[model samples]
Every structure is written in C-alpha cells, then in structure tokens.
Target: SVILFLNKVVISQVICKALLVPINPLFVCSRHIRNRYKRISASKMESATEPGESVAGKSTAMTAGQKKEDRMKRFRELHLKRNEARKLNHQEMVEEDKRLKLPSNWEAKKARMEWELQEGEKKNDCLARGEDYERVKLLEVSAEDAERWERKKKKKNPDPGFSGYAEAQLRQYHRLTKQIRPDMEEYEKQREACGEDFHPTTNSLIHGTHVPSKQGIDRMVEDVSEKQIEKRAKYSRRRAYNDDADIDYINERNAKFNKKAERFYGKYTAEIKQNLERGTAV
Candidate 1:
C-alpha cells in the first residue's frame, strides 16, 4: 500500500513539473519518502552548482537580499530618475518665451486676412463677368455658434442652478425668448413705417397695447380681469419691493425689519445702494 501511495505521489509531482506549477505543499507520503525526495533534490542542486553546469548567463551565487538591492538600484536609475535629475542645475533651464507674440484679436485678424485674400482673387473674376462682390458673411448665426457665445456669456454672468433657489419659471421664460426667432425684416419695415415721433415707450407693439397675438387671449384676459384680478391681487402675497433689493436678512423676522428699514433709509442711500449693487463701490 505504501509503494502504491508513493507511485501516485511520484505521478502527481511529475504531472506538476510537466504543468510548470509548484507541487502542492499539503501533498505528503510517509516521512521516509519525503526524506528520500529531499536527498535527491539536494544531489541535483549540488550538481547544478558545478562550474559551467548552471544555466547560461544566470548566476545563483547572489543571496535574495543582494539581488533585491541590485534590482531596486536598477529600478531607481531606469524608472524613478529623480536621483539623477537632482544632480542637474534647475536654475540653468533654457529661457522659454512665456509671452508668445500675437496680434490683437489674432483669431479674427487671421480670418479677415484669409477672407480678404479670397475676395482679391474673386474681384478679378467678378469684374470680368460684371458682378458685384457681395458680402460673404452670413446674417444668421449657426445654433452651435450661438450656443458657444451663450456659454461664454454664462461663464462671465453665471445663471443659478435649480437647486440654488432660483426662480425656475422666470428663468424658463427668459430662456424661451432666445428660441423665439422674430422676422427682422418685418420689424425693420414696421420701424420705418412708424413716424419720426415714435418712441419706444409709445410704440403700441412694444408695449403690447396692440391686440393680443393669440386668437382669444383678449377676451380671456378681459373675462379673467373682471373676476380674478381683484380677488387674486387684493393683497400681494410675494414681496413687492424693488426686484434688485439687497438680500441681507437671515430669517423672516429679520427680513420684515430690513424691509421696514429700507423704506425709511432707501431714498437717502439710493445712490450708494446702486453703486454697491453694480460692484462699483470703492
């Protein structure tokens, strides 16, 4: 039974070696077999230690600690080169052109130059054919260009997020105006038709004194005004002070006190208040 057990273990070790995997540490035969295996391995190691008998270009003389230290040294030199860099003079760096020369509005300037060149080439052809060199620029901006400009403006004058307690409905209303593309030609025509005495304040269309654009909006507004206008606006629920009122109050009671104070001091400090609001106060 012991011999058969040894046969199985020998087969397993041979299989592990063939598979190039470590022999299982838990695998055990009797003490005698283990001792015999150790002796055979020792003899093999001794044979390998013979000069010119080892694997070519491989040395086994260095201890693990020595090998690890050499590997670390090589790694520091190869990958982590800060130690080598420390020896160089950082003060003697090549003078970099921090301010690269560029003409004012270089982007637009370059575009204009290219456009002019193209126009010069077209001018000769146009004169030969008796045609005028009309404007190459488009009147309407692309959605992407408008979006880019809007984004730039927003960066300078950022809009509040919904979470920031902003007026969501009011913001949405203002945003809707951007999407409304009014007929510029019709607008210009109307302006020309209007007499020289036409002021913006007196312009019926501008002030919405004209009939409502919607079919039945006039009737609905009139009907609503008769019933709901007085009832709904009997007492204003929302604050009715200047929309540009300073927000210095922390609580409801503080806000009421501030509102009362503003009424009395508002006239006296109006200019100062405006300066502060506009960030022009020294």
Candidate 2:
C-alpha cells in the first residue's frame, strides 16, 4: 500500500507539471487549433479525476478568427449608426417648391426682374445726366426665355405667302408700314373702279367670253408694257473700269490678296522699300 501510494504521487506530480507548463500556440490551421484545445481539455479532465495537487486554470488566448470577428462587428456597428442618421436627416428635409408642387421658374423669373431693375436704374441715370435714353432691348438667355423668344421671332419675322415674284420688299416693310394708317376711302374708290370684273381672267374679253371693251384692252396693254420697262430698269447697272488706273495684279482675285497684304504690312516695310529704291540698301 505504501509503494502504490508513492507511485500515484509521482504520476500526479508529472501530470501537474505538464498541465502547468505554458503552451506556445503556433499560427496554424483551424484543424490543428481544435485538436490542440481538445488535447489540453482531455488532459485537464484526466487530471481532475485522480489529482494529488490541483493545476492552475488554463489561460485561453484568443484565436486569429475570433479577433477578426470582433473587429468586423465593431465596424458594422459604427458605419450603420452613421448611415442611419444621415438617411433620417434626408427624409426630414422639405423644400417649399417641391411641397407646393409649383413649376420651378425661379431662375428665369429672377433674371427677367433683375434685368428690368437694371434698365430702370440706367434710365434714371440718363435722365439725371440730361441725355435721351434710347431703348436698348436685349432678351437674356434663360430656361423659360425660349418660349418668349419663339413668340417674338414668329411675330416680328412673319412668313410672307408665296407670290409670282420674289416678294423681297415684304422684308423690313413692317418697320416702314408701322407709321402708315389704313385708308378705307381710297380702298373703296379702287374697288369701284374695278367694277363687277374685279376678278379679271386673261383672254376673257379678247375671246368675247366676257363683254369686250376698247378702254379695258388698251389699259391692259399699257400695264404690261410698263411692268416690262420697270423690270429692265431695276436690274441694269452701268459698270465702267478706268483704263488710266495702274494694273499691279494678275487678276481681280490676285488684286484683292495684294491689297490685303499691303494694308497689313505696308507701314512696317515703307522705309526699307524707299531705301532699296534709292540704291542705299546694304
């Protein structure tokens, strides 16, 4: 019984020494980690059952995986809290225009009013200085200004309906005609002169389909000849070239080019040209 008791003491002491010794955990795979912890726990259990001296508790050091998980959990908590606050603030803010559902023309309205105010100020200054204020109108480019510009352009530059002639005189005619007033008296007098044959057709009187009149035939012939004469006079122009003028260029095109070059550099080279001509140039 004494020998058996000594053997048990020695065995317990050896197991206690092994358990108390610190484990240097090498950085390895999960399989090695699980096996290492299981072996230490199994030894602890065996020692617990037949222990003479009690070993101090095993100090479990954290694994790399557990440390990484804790770090990620903290990160999520911080970012999520900040992002949720921002979202709540965004939802709380309300714009007046959006809330009222009004068409946003703030930019265009502000620009137009500002322009009017500036013009008024300018006019006041001009009056104080005893100068006539010429109305200098220029529309500013803006968001809603497109529609206004379209209407103005349509009214001012109206499309003239097609006529037998080019009808070029209609352009700028509005500016001249603005001062001219309607003469209903003259219009009625002209209508009376035309009579019932107001809508005249060509060769109607000549073929006797309409009653022929010597006066109307003569009037028609006279009108046609006058128009022909007026057309010829309108296009004809007298162009005379001077024979006395110096011919310094090859052609009209070359003449234009030489004139341009001379206009740009003539002053700079004038003295040099004079020196060369006098045989004094080095």
Candidate 3:
C-alpha cells in the first residue's frame, strides 16, 4: 500500500507539473514540501537499516562479546562466511592451478613438455639467424657503398673547421719546414761530400789532410801548452784577496826597522853636534 502510494505520488508529480496548473500556488509551499519529503526519506532510511547487511549484501558485523552464547554465535557466523569465501576463492585458484600444473593426458602433456624444451632451442636458432644476417650485411658492404658513404661524409664536412689563426699557424709551420728542408739537405750534402780527409781530429779541430802546416800546428801546440802552464802557476801564486796576516807581519817589520834606523841617526847627530861645538871652542 505504501509503495503504491509512493508510485502514484511520483507519477502525479511528473505528469501534473507540465500539464496542470496549480489552483493556488501559495498552498504548495516549496520549503514545507521539501521538509515533509526529507522526513519521509529519513524514516525510510532508518527502517531499512539491518545489522551486518549493506546495500551490496556484504556483511559488516562486529561480533565481539564475552558471553559464551554470543561467542558461539559469532564463531558460527564467522565459520559460515569463511567457508563461503573459501569456496569462491578455491574456484578462482582452480583456474590458476590449472595454468600452473602439467596437463593430465599423457600425449598432450608430452607434447607440451616437448614444446617447452624446444622453446629455448628455437630462440637460440632465431638469435643465430639474426646474428648471421647481421654478419652478412656487414660483409656485404661494397666499394660503391663505401664510396657513396665517403661522398656523403665529404659533402657533410668539405670545409676544415680551422679558424684564421689555426690556418695561419699551419701555414707558418709548413713554410718553416719548407725553409728548413734546404738547410737540412745542404747539411746532409756537405756531410756526404766530405771524405775522411776532411774529418775532425780528437781535439774537435778540423785536422785532416787539409789541416794547417806542421810548423803552424807545432807552434800552436807549444803556445797552448805554455799558456796552460802559465795559467796554473798564476793560479797557484794567487792568494785570497782578504789575506791579512802577511800584510800585518810586513807592516810590523817595517815599523821596527824604521824605529831602529831613526835611533841610530839620532845618536850620530848628537855626537856630531858635540864634536862641532868642541872644535869651535878650540
């Protein structure tokens, strides 16, 4: 009866809103109508509430208690729910187990095993074929292909990436080498042109068939030896510039000799004065 009433009310609202105008719009207070509908909805919602039951039929029970009767009841409910869930989970896991397990039929199982065994071999063969293809492709590069690649590369970078300074440096090096080549070649030619007769002696002087005359050689040798001896003698005679002992000894000896000579002169002069006075008196 209540459901029939609700259905009729919904239908009337939907149909009458567009077709029938309200005799007295003030009689239908929108706020009062909404409040009435809200109260009805709340009552329905409260009456519909049940323990451990949701709109989706899932249980949300709180079975915690100390009484033996409540505990047993809770255990029974929990065991029932667990059994139901286990049944459904077992059904799901059965498919997964089938996926994991070998087939039961011997021939089909043997075929699957063989396929699994040869899977690695087939992959290896494919890999080997791919490697062979790569090797063949690498070996198949012809001179024309190389030349084409070279042309592409040459076209890509025909210009050297050197700045003016770098180019000038390279040009300078080339010019220097060009200038040095003649000198090096001339040196080599001179070295080659000279025979044993123009070779240097042990003294690093050019002493060969074209050397100075024997007389000149002997005079030069004698002069050099004499100069070396004189240099040694001068070095041996040389004393440190700050040597003071010899200077001090010579100064003391000169002082003593000067004092002795002055005394002898003074004594003789005294004797001459006395003798001259004596002769005058006579």
Candidate 4:
C-alpha cells in the first residue's frame, strides 16, 4: 500500500510539471478572451467612427443645433467682409448708366406715334388701290350691260331663286363696307391733314433698343468653358448660396438650347441652298 501511494504521488508531480511548460496550441477560441479586451476593441471602433457618432456612448462633438449656429456665424462674417465689394460694384454700375445716358420708356412714345401714322397711310393707299380697281372694272362695261349679261348667264341654267342685278349690287356693297369706329375715322382724317411722311424702314427711331432682362445683381459667376468649369470644381474655395447641382443643371440646359438652335439654323440654311439649286423661290 506504501509503494502504490508513492507511485501515485510521482505521477501527480509529472502531470503538474507538464501543465507548467508552454506548448504550441492546436486550436484557440476567440470567445475565450477577457471582457477587458472586448471593451478595448469597442473603443477603437468608436474612435474610427465619424464625428457626432459613437458606438457605446453619446458623441462628445457638436450636435445639429451647434452645427447650425456655427454655419450662421460663418455667414455673418463673410457678409460683413464683402460689404465693401458690393457697394463698389453698385457704384460702378450707376456711374456707367449715367455716362451712357440711357433713355426712359417714354422716349419711344413719339416713335410709336409715327409708326401709327405710317400704318394709317398704308391703309389709305390700300383703300385707294381697291377703289381704282373697282372704277376700272366699272368703266370696262356699263352697269346695265353687266346686269343683262349676268341675267342671261344665269337664265341659261335658271332656278326659282335667281335674284337679279339689284341683289348683286347689294352683295357688292356689303362686301366692300367693313366696320370702322367714328373715332378711328376722325383720327385718320387728322393724320392725313398733317401731311407727315412716316415710313417704318426709313426711321431708325421706330425700332427701340433692347434692354437687358436682368440687372446683373444676382448673376452666377461666369464659367464660359468646360475646362474652366473643371478648374472651378478643383479650386473654387468660395461656396455659393446655391448648390453646385443647380449650377450644373442650368449649364446643361443652356448647352442643350444652343445645340438645338445650331441644328435648326443648319437645316434652314441647307433647305435654302437646295431651293436655290432647284430654281425655287425661298
């Protein structure tokens, strides 16, 4: 019994020595790591996240409200800085306008009046031509002869509803007379008595100069070329009130309209050349 007990004691010591020695591991479980290790890994992940975001705790960075306040502060600073530039540009525009001596809208009123007079003269000329044509037609044959001839022509294929020369005269008068206001007649008579020569093509004042639609106060920064646009994209540190997306959209639309106009004018010119080749009036 003593020898058996001594052998068991020796075996126990050998097992303990084997456990104390280090050896290569056949397998390792990731789950066996300490909670402290897990916490360290989680902290690294949180630090890698964007500002205003946190994995296991509230973000220490500015909130949405604080961001808005910061943006407003920046805007105020920029506006204050650019105030002189705005004033200088406005002064320049005003001085330029004064030097050019731009006319008021009422400056064209007299030209419009002259245009009206020319139109009246044209109308009178048309009426005179019509009257001359009728007179010549009447002189070619007597009224009685015309009536007799018309009756004979109709009688050749007469029906019960053959109204005579008086009916024809009534129809002619109705066709010649158009409605005219009493005021328009008086105006025309006054215009005729003035003996003024009003011709549209002869008078440069008749066509007024075209004014720009916008005051240029809010015009987008000029970008005339694609290369310039790309350069702007790369280096434009100054931000606009509007988004870049809207500017790009407008540029694309303008390009489309320009392309369309070019195509239309190209086709129009081609058609004109073809007409000339074929000896057709264009």
Question: How many residue pairs clash (N, CA or C atoms closer than 3 angstroms) in each of the candidate models, in the order given?
Answer: 0, 0, 0, 0
TM-scores of the candidates in the order shown = 0.20, 0.22, 0.15, 0.16
> What would the per-residue lDDT of candidate 1 be over residues 1-282, giving only the tens digit for each residue?
578777877988898899998986365555557877899999998887875655432455446668899999998777657745654535234222322356558779889999989878877777787766553222345779978988888789653233222466677568656765776776676667665634655544545544434634765586467745676468455444666856789997787777666756879888998899899999
Q: Which numbered prediction scores highest in TM-score against the true structure?
A: 2
Put down candidate 4 lDDT per residue, 106-168, tens digits, no spaces: 458768989989767766786877755445546678879999999999879532221345755
* Cα distance off (Å), candidate 3, residue 67: 33
lDDT leaderboard ranking = 1, 2, 3, 4
Give the top-scoring candidate (lDDT).
1
Model 2 steric clash pairs: none
Which parts of model 1 have CA positions greater than 4 angstroms off?
1-103, 125-132, 135-282
Q: Which ten residues in a row have the lowest lDDT in candidate 2?
A: 52-61
Candidates 1 and 2 compared: the better one by lDDT is: 1
**lDDT of prediction 4:** 0.59
Query: Candidate 3 at 187: error in angstroms?
Result: 8.1
Q: Give the TM-score of candidate 4.
A: 0.16
Over the stretch 8-72, how does candidate 2's per-residue lDDT look in tens digits? 55665677678895333242234455776899999998888654333222222345567889999
Model 4 steric clash pairs:
none
RMSD of each: 27.2, 22.2, 40.6, 38.4
lDDT for position 49 in model 1 = 81
Candidate 3 ranges with C-alpha deviation above 4 Å: 1-140, 152-157, 160-162, 171-188, 194-282
Clash count in backbone of candidate 4 = 0
Worst 10 residues of 4 by lDDT: 23-32
